[model samples]
Structures are given as structure tokens and as C-alpha cells.
Target: MPGVAERLTIDHVGQRGDGVSLTNGASLFVPYTLAHEIVETERDDEHPERRRLLQIDTASPERIDPFCTYFTRCGGCAIQHWQPDPYQAWKRQIVIDTLAQAKITCPVDPIVDAHGAGRRRVTLHARRGSDGGLRVGFAASASHAIIAIDACPILDPALDGALDAARALAEVLKPVSKPLDIQVTAASNGLDIDVRGTGPLPTAIITALSRIAEAHKLARLTRHGELVLMRVPPVVTMGSAQVTLPPGSFLQATAAGEETLAALVLQLCKGAKNIADLFCGIGPFALRLATKSKVTALDSDGGAITSLQQAIKDTKGLKPIKAEMRDLFRRPLVPQELRDFDAVVFDPPRQGAQAQVERLAASKIPVVVAVSCNVQTFARDAKILIDGGYKLESVTPVDQFRHTPHIELVARFKR
Candidate 1:
């Protein structure tokens, strides 16, 4: 049994942004407890984990009821208890803290909130439960526990329905001869569903699902209204150019987000005749910038490079943009390779671009746009750039993932 800690008065939230207080001078982290709250905590003696709040003796006025039914159990979102305004502010602070850690000081501009924001392109997960039902949802906070969800408020309506359909299918499918994982995307056609497992989906299952999808008018395995049997289809037009996106490929989840990012990249590349785009997935920025300047797009994914090459071939008005497959972790872009480019743009994963920061400093590109999802890593990398003698220009926070702690930022740097 856990020990009962004396009631503690909550002072404020900690780095995790959860309300924090002290019990007998030992630190305690409590979720859903706001500033100036008094709470009784249950301390876990078995482990080094923080004590849990058992009950709130006093609650803050800012606390509100979460809109989602699964707020407590579903790990898709954090900070649901915070009001919208404060939540946004906290996210901004996170970006600031990240930049500070990197030893870079820049004026963070007003956050750009995403409109119609819940359109997620893909979600993947394993089956769950004793019945082995498909548990298609985000992993629990800091744990592997799968949170089975019927609907995700943050996902596009079309994609949410697909999740439901997948759940329904899981109910009827045979219990556990194999594992099941799924991916759904909103393509130009409608919605596309990719069901993957150890073996090919039985013909009967596919036929049955197809019928169900048609009857329900659900989008399945199609792009921009075109029927595609394979999950990964060949090239489509990016401004009259053939560009292919492979299955499991990384593309901007939202069409609007992609457009917004493209515009920003082009704007930043102004007056630059040469550019380098690192981790350039599917040439979202590289292809777009091609109209203005010669761009070299680098990514580790070979399949993506194939698609990018195809896109360049199909587009008539595109400026010369070349794609290469290189593992950044093993071999980062060096000064020699970067000397030709007047500017550089990088979009790294949530882990941030720490591995390549040194090389970026060495290149000293006159202009750099560092796009990031993780604020902490972004700040860390920003510090490196500052140390490398780059001046921080501006920090723009884009609400790519609304109603969640996740944020996207574009930090401009100049030498």
C-alpha cells in the first residue's frame, strides 16, 4: 500500500507543467492541480516516482472541465484542464525556455493558431486487450499502455470515422492469429486506409471491408478521389509535376499546414539563389522553393528521394532542385557541401536537430530557417547556432497541433 503524505499546498506547476508542491520538503508533482491549490497526496514508497494527488482540497478558478470524455485515460493530449488562453501561453513559454537553454535570445512573435486544425493524416498502433482488438490510438503518457479510442476530437472528421470503421472491423475479425496495425490519411480523393499485418489481408476480409466502405460512403485506399489499390501510390502532380509519396512516407499531415510552411520557406529564401533543405521529406519545402532558386534537398529516406526526383521531372516551371539520400546522423552536411547555398532550411523530427547543429554552425549559411516540433530541442539547437555566431532573427510559433502541448515553430537565423 502507498504511504499517505500530509496535505500539501500547491505552489505552481513544474517543467512538466503539472502543478507542483512539497510534502515534508520533498517535491511532489500533481496533475490537474493548479497554482494556489491545496491537495492531499498519496506518496509511492516503492519507486522514485513523484507523489500523486489523491484529492484537491482547494482548486484554482482557472481549472475547467475537460471537453473530452477520455481526458483522464486517453493519452492523446495533455493540459486539457487548462483554459484555452492559458494553455496557449504555457506553450509559448515552453518555446522560450527551449530557446533559453540553447543560449539564444530572440523575440518570439505571436503564435499563429491553426484553423480547422484537427486534420491528422496518419495514426499507427498495435492491437490491445484480451480479445486482441486493434488499439489504434496514442500511447499513454510516459507509458506503453494503449488508449483505445473510438473518436479523436483532434483528428479530421473523415479520419475519425475511418478509425471507427477500423474498430468495428476489429470486433468481427478472428481473435489473434496475427497482429494488426493501421494507417489512415486524408488524400485528395477522400480517405485512405492502410491495414498492415504479418501477412496479406485475407481476400474475404478485404472484400467485406470494401463493401462496408462503399455502403457507408467512407473513403478507402484512394487519393484525391482516385481509387488506388496499393497503400502507396505513384507520383501525382505538384504544380504539373509528377510527385510520388510512398506508403509509411512522412508528409505534412494537413494540406493547409503544408501550404503555410511552403509560403514561409519561400519568403525566408528571398534574395537567395541557392538553398539547402535538410531532412527534406518529400520536398515539401524543396519542391516549392524550386520556383525561386536552385535547392538541394537531403533526407535519409530513399523512397522519398525517388518521389522527389519524380516531382522535379514532372514540374515544368520548377527551378533546379536535386534530392539525395543521406543519413544525417552518420554524415551531416559539411561546410564544403553548404558553401554554395546562400540559405538553409531544416525540418527535423521531434528529437530536434542537435546532431547536425555543429555542421550547421560550420557552414555559416547567411540565412537559416530552423523548423521544429519539440520546443526543448529547438532551444538546444538554437543555442548551438548562437554560439556559432548566428544572430537570432525571429521565432514564430505555429499551432500545428491545437489543444495539445505539441507546437511547431520556425526560427530564422542570420549570420
Candidate 2:
């Protein structure tokens, strides 16, 4: 099947940015192709329904040369060759189509490009090659094989030395050679490095890593978020507040993306005296909303809640923020608890907030803002909210992880 080549015409782009061609009553997914393009492809050995693009017989007029050398090799980006105009439209249409499929109607706004300064963080995988050599970079497309890279174009300029730092750390840990995932975050002070997948390290190895951190001028080094060493606390500015990030803390991919999503949230929740920030991570929305309204920040992450509480103590001239560590999935705020807040905001993980939304739907909270990264799940949750008598007003898509299928959206719901 791998060697058998076939010609196909791409009909359209699928949700994952792959070109789809109907064949023999089945769909064939081909990557790195555009709609209405003729291409020669071969059936992939790993995936039966997928084809590997071998040659482009006819290219689309919208196609452009990809900027990155690792365009097709690295799995990080999906579509970098398409023109911006069509690409943005395709992204916005994704939201519209997804919403329509769920039978929910709302005004979907134009996509906002929030990839201002590129991604501020990256996770590099490190594995030992068969020859006992270390490979540090992203995994190859559709495979577990690592594509060793010296630098990545999509990363922010602040993470200039992230690859080198990961490689250097991998070199030190090469003896055990257990696969390593090094997450590097560019913060206000310096790079915050977190190493995972290593069960444990001896003191000698820990000392070596500490020296490497010093040599790299990293703000801190952590093993699975347990601090190995902290030369300085890694701080991230969230609106007016300064938040010291815990190791492996969740952060919006781009600084501009956070601001963009927060702006939309604030615009919809304006004039509310009380606000509830659900799944509030490091107070990105909570801290900003506190400037104009009393904020109650809820999250399951104790580290995040503690950090938010600490930030409130250090900042000035802001409304009171009550930070609580509660798992919304297990115990979402019910209608009784939701009655006090004039506005409620929930930014859940990819699974969306079905359980939480069920409770929020039962409440009469005047203004509700939903932020999500997964469109399909968001649509399902929106349907639930609409069923509970809330009106879906506006949905604005945010593109922070450019060239990837992933997108974020902020929506407003009113009674």
C-alpha cells in the first residue's frame, strides 16, 4: 500500500487542515494539499484512510512557499502554505459551521489574529537514537520519530536559546536516556525550564542540572514542577498584576492572545459589580476584571490559586479577589452559588465545561461569557446553555497558535 501511488483531486480542507478526496465511497485524507488541487499520493502504511502526498500535479493559486524549513517534516504546524485571507476565512468558517451543525445560531465575528509575537513557550522531546546519540526537537509528522532541530521559527524571539537549552540538558541526562519532555517558558525574568518523564534523579545529577541552569541563565529549573532550583521566580504579567508562575503552569501561547481574549471578555461583562472567573489560571481574567469589579477566582489548581492570592496581596488599587481551589468538574457552582454574581466567565479545558455549564444554565446569571479552545465541545456546551433559556449573542474566534488547526473563541450569552 505504501508504494502504490494514486492520483486524486482535493475537494476541500477537512477540520484538521487535511485535504479530503472522496474515493470508492470512502474519504481519503491527504496532508499539505489545498482544495481544488490535483495531487499524486500513496496510501500510508500507518494509516489506511490517509494518503501521503508525493507530488502536486496542480497547485492552488492561493498556495505560497512555507517560511519554515521544517514545514512538512515537523508536526507542529498544519497549514503554513495557504494565503492569509483564505486561511482566516477558513478558521472563522470553522466556528460558523460547527455552530450550525449543533443547531445553535449566533453572530460569528471575523477571526482576530492574536499571533502577535509568536508562541512564548515550547515543549521539546528528547530521545536517544539507535546509535546512542541524543535527538532533541519535535516529533515528525504522524510518527513518534523526533526531528532534531536547532531552532523553531514559530517560537517567540524570547525563546531563542530554548532548543540549545533543551539539548544541553538532554546531554546531561543521556546516560539514563529515558525519553524526556522539556517544557520551556519565556518569562519576564528568564526561561523557566521543566523536565518531565524522568522518574527521579540522584543528587549528583541534580547538581549537574543546577549548574546547567546557571550556565543557561534560566530563572528556574523544575522536575515535573517540583523545584530543583530557583535562581529567580519566573513572573508573567497578567493585566495590571504580576504573577509568579509555578513550574509547568498553564499559560496562553501568546501574550497578545491573552489580551485579545480578555478584551472580548471584559467588553461583554462591562458594568457588572461582581464577576466569577471559573477555571481562572493565574488570574489572567480575574486580575484584570478586579480593576472594575469584585472578582471570585475558582480553579482546581492549588498552585495557580495560591499564585493568584499572592498576586492580589502584592498589587494595589484593585477590587477584592477571592481565590478558591475547587474542581469545577466535580463540584461546579450551582444556581444558588451563581446567584450572587452579576457576570460569570468560564474558560474550560478542551473537554469544555458540560457539567459546569449544566449548572450555569440553571442559574439566572445575567451575563455569561464562555471561552474555549475546542470548537466542537464549545458548540455542544452552547446548545446546553441555549436550551436553558440563555441567548447566544456573539462568538469571536481567536487565532493564537497560527498555522495549526487549534483555535480559541470567546462568546457572550444573555438571558
Candidate 3:
């Protein structure tokens, strides 16, 4: 059931970039709104706390015409309405606040800017249009409705033709009734595509997909992590070494972001003779850290370890890097296992590395570099390490995903 239209003055910006309004006693969240701006909204009964922003009764100084034409509708970006300088400050403050909540304090470096157009990789949703034509683009905000886009300003120039490429691929991938999730990355040579949401691949579909890969010059094509076709091995340069990126392997959204994270890791872990790189995806830090220190890279995924080992073997002029497949969460490297490494560098996913950090806190490692995508989880882990006598040195905030509230940080710790 739809609620009646109402008006409310947005009191503040919430963590997710939605504006908050104190309507009577309850809080209302309006998307694309700003602090202290009066906006018209309709309270959503399904989500009592959320309000759909109908129109701005009064605009804000921080509000600007979003750069992307698909601004509010497309789920790709959030906070595009914010001006750059203020946006940067606010995002940095988020890290500050998160650490403060955990009773930890340290110098936080200014937010690093996202380079060029937003991202090199984008996953477009493909569906059969109402007229039975291939519709390829992003899903709407909080919706499964596909928005067929002509252009996406936020994507890399190399991927400007991605929509058409996905559409062409979808044509070959006929009989896919449900929407296809196509993850396309603009690699060094050509597009790296990993398609999902399709049923099991038979011989006939695989043959056609091979032809599609050839026509589009796709560097590689994969389905459900299984290789369908590969014109050439997809390569990603991690520092000096070019690691063959296993299909669906995690890569940083931007090249500059990877360099920033790697540079910081190299700087902080400077003098240590041995370092453990945990959750090391394709040697983003291991390959680089091996330049100065002996690095042992470990990940749960064997393919990632294999790729890193292969790169180290094929590349020249790098110190020794040992790769291993180990699940750190289930059986974290104990203090005894980590005793050999003087310094530790761990970059975990959004959930952060609680299990690994617990062991790192107990270890006598002189230096630890924690790279995380979630500030709250990072703060939690930081507290664990600090409680174990590690001192929080400094945190560098990297804004790889521009115009979005998502934040990444590289924090250095020492006794």
C-alpha cells in the first residue's frame, strides 16, 4: 500500500549517503537528498524508515547535477550529487568517526581520488526486452528492472562499447530467459568477460560462444567460473610481474587504486626481511612486496595462488615469493606459523580478517599493514590488534569508487 505524500527537512546525511529526516519521532531516509534541505517524499510502508525523494522543496549547496545521465535510476553510483571537495572530506571523516567509535585514534591521510572515468569493469544485466530484443545495461536502483543504456559516462573509454558487446554476446547466448549477469573488464589486450545467470553450457552453446568471443575479440570468456573460450590468457600486471588473472579473479576497480595500495604497503613494510601477504589476490601486494622482502602469499583460492606463482616464475628481477592455498578463516596461521615473518600485510574482503587479525595480534610481528574496504570492520580489527599492544600509526583513505560512499583504507600498525 502507498502512503500519503509528505514533506520533511533533511536533518543530516546518513552513512549510506541517504539524507535523514526527523518526521515527528521516527527517522526517514531519502535518497539523493542533502543535509538541511527540505524535500518532498512519500513514506514507503514496506520500509517504514525509508522515504522516496519526490522533489527537492529546497536545494542544497553541495548538490550538483550528477555527471552520469543515469544518476538516481541506475544502481551504479551513489553520492554523485555531492561536490568533490566536500565529498572527500565527508568520506574521510567517516573513517575518523568509525575509528573513534572503536576508541582508536590516529592520523588519517586525506582521501585519494579515483582516476579518470570511474571503473574499468562493469557488470551489465541482460534480458529480453518487451519486444523480444536483447536489452543490455544496468539494473535500476533497488530494482530488478533493467535500464537499457545508450552510454555510461562512469565507465572507462575502452569500455564505452561494452553495452553493444554484451548485447551481441547475449544474442549468441540465446534461450536465456532470465537476465544474464555479464561482468566485463577492459584488460590490456581486450575485454575479459565472465557471464553468469545462464543455465548449464552444452556443446552447441559453447561452440557459438567461441564464435562470439572471436567476433568481439574477447580476451577470455567464462561461465560460472568455468572457461568457455580464451583467445589469449588474460594478464594483469601486479607491479612488475604480469599475473595471468584467473577468470573471475578479483582485481581492483582501477589501476591507480592498486598502485596506491601496493605503494603504501611497500612503504610501511620497508625494512622487514620477511612478510606474510594474507588474502593475497593474484599477488597485488605479494609480487610488489617481494621486490624488497621475502613474501609468502596465501589465499583460499588455489587458482589465485597458481597465478601468482606462475607470474613470479615467469617474471625476472623480483625477490622470492612463495604462494600457498590456505583458508585463513577456518585455520588462521598461528603465532608459531607466522613467527618467521617480521612484518605482515593482510588485505581482506568487506567482512575484514578477524580470524587472521586475532593471530596477528598475538604474534610478535614488528609491523602490520591492514588493507580493508570496510571502515567499520577495519576499526574492529584495529581494536583487536591495538588491544594486543600494537600501536595505530596512520590510515590512508583511498577513494577508488568515486561518487560512492564505499571507502577503502590502508592502515599501518606497529608496537
**TM-scores for the candidates:** 0.84, 0.99, 0.96
Per lDDT, what order, best first? 2, 3, 1
Note the residue pairs that clash in candidate 3: none
* Stretches > 4 Å off in candidate 1: 1-6, 40-48, 51-55, 124-126, 131-143, 168-179, 196-228, 231-243
What RMSD does model 3 have?
A: 1.6
Q: Distance (Å) between predicted and true CA of 273, model 1?
A: 1.6
Q: Which one wins on TM-score? A: 2
Tens-digit per-residue lDDT, 153-239, candidate 2: 888898988888898899999876699999999998899999998888898999999999999999999999898889999999988
| TM-score-superior candidate, 1 or 2 | 2
What C-alpha lDDT do the candidate models reach, one value each? 0.72, 0.94, 0.87
Cα-based lDDT at residue 246, candidate 3: 82
Model 3, position 376: C-alpha lDDT score: 92
lDDT of 3 at 98: 90
At residue 222, give the lDDT of candidate 1. 33
For residues 358-385, write the lDDT of model 3, one tens digit per residue.
9999999899999999999999999999
